[model samples]
Target: MSEQGSSDTYEENERVLVHHQGKIYEAKVLKVEHTDTNNKRKRNTLYLIHYQGWKDKYDEWIDSSKMLKLNEKNKELQRKPLSSLKKKPNNNINQQHQQQQQQQQQHHSEESDDGRPTPTPSPSTAGTSTTTTTSTTSTSSTKRKRVDASVQESQRLDLSLPETLRKTLIDDWVFITNDKSLVALPRNPTVSDILDTFQQQHQHLEHVKQFADGIESYFNKALGVMLLYKFERPQFGEMVKLHPNKPMSEIYGAEHLLRLFVKLPDLLTLTELEDKTSVVLSKATEELIKYVEKNASTFFLKEYAPVTTYYSRLAN
Candidate 1:
């Protein structure tokens, strides 16, 4: 949660409407972090949040952005999980984090998505190319950089999609793009859950564990820029609304996680790797996806939740 107003912060024991599990619940701030930082850069405030009724096991380090004062109006704010928001959303996955300050006016209605006019990249990622020199104008320099980044994205990824899983990707696409329905977010068996399960199942293979980190590292990094479709960008958007700077793979479900598989080759285009290492890594990726696909029955959402659930529409 990156955006916070001064009033948003709370003293220890302050009650808050915690946005958790796609629903808001009352919680108390048990502890606060980053209270001492005075640097000019954005200081992320982490709260040791204790859900009122949940056992201590549910306590989490929550970003301040997700904390809302416990008030009647704020109570109904649609803190819908990204895996579950209804309606249209914009594209340009990376820009999801360039969040505007929370809209003060009540947002009683669902957000509508028009086509995105441009693409944006995350600050953490550097453009792969820098050779193109442009005019002194800032806009021209920015264009030059984007062109360079696109150049590296062109490198043919070493990983190939398995035929069966490839077919699943097609189904996933039609489910979202053509069906106009989203896989309700904070998904059950989230991408994070699935990955962790896979890692646990294969812990004996240390290399597989390492590759899990490899994929997770890039999954958090590349998901915004590489993994999202225009309609699905709403998933990422809902996340930003509730938890900025948090990794998407963790909260997003198997549906969006599958997108990571499609884009990983392009996103992780490793031009500098040795040929032998590349083959081993590519083989590892194949093995990982096969495991994920094999458990589709348990992992994938069977009935896509309509964004306009009665509870959601009744919110606020």
Candidate 2:
């Protein structure tokens, strides 16, 4: 399928409208597959879909090209009226409100127990009552403010791959700095130029040293010192291992560290070469890929690009 077409298709678990047997029904994508034709040269994409009201036996793969994606507007149109499903509050809430009113009436009645008209509350007593009510109101308001702040803290904006990185990533040439910043370089930047850029961008920052230190720790835990050195001059068929205790800075200089950031694709490719016959990926490489995928959205939004375009560049 074309990149444009693939992007338009519903992703897994996304709701869509499916046309089947002269009827249209809401369906969800269960899986997506990109395969080759019988000749094994042409790409064909299929979506495994399950219609909302259909039997399990009826669930089947459909051509992705035929699927209709439901946008937010379409979804709103399809949603059933919530009023029909909403349940009225239980009797307990009403009972509590009634009990509070009854208690206040009883207090007023006790004030007139002698059957004579009750005297007005003295200034001091009224003042104390007002103060108590004010305190209670303030406490409730403070609790509400705390709840609002907690909710705000829990909500986080989604991240995406940046367009600048996306465009450069397709060419397999981009650098992600230790500070999680992205820089898109011209095609095929030389090692010297890449290193220079890294230094120029982060040299003055006081945190650069700390960031570099963190990178060293990451190298120690993820790619052992020996494997990391090998990454600089990777040989074919050599297995990469994690060396948790090895010190990265003592063994590998700053140049190798900078190269690691700039030549990430190359490093991943090398890992792939080493584990070609294996089913599982290297732990370090898997972690790296996951980070990229997870932050792709955040990075994309900062640079502001279509999600499809970002994904297309990633695939490249």
- Top candidate when judged by lDDT against the true structure: 1
Q: Give model 1 RMSD, 1 decimal.
A: 21.2
Instruction: Quote each prediction's TM-score.
Output: 0.47, 0.24
Displacement of residue 203 (Cα, Å) in model 2 is 2.4
Give me the runs in candidate 2 sitting further than 4 Å from their true place.
Answer: 1-68, 71-161, 168-197, 219-237, 241-316
lDDT of 1 by residue, 169-274 (tens): 5555445543446677777776777778888887665477777777777777766665565556655667878977677776877766676775565455555555
TM-score of 1: 0.47
Estimate, for each residue in 1-316, the C-alpha lDDT of model 2 and write its tens digit.
2222223656789888543321235778988766433334555556767766544434545554335567654343234232311232354422332333344344334321111111122122111223577878788787896786455423311122233333333222111211112222111232333233444555654444443344455444433322222112221111223333434333333223332443333233333232332222233333333444444443222221122444334422
TM-score, structure 2 vs. true: 0.24
**What does the lDDT read for residue 294 in candidate 2?**
49
Worst lDDT window (10 residues) for model 1?
Answer: 108-117
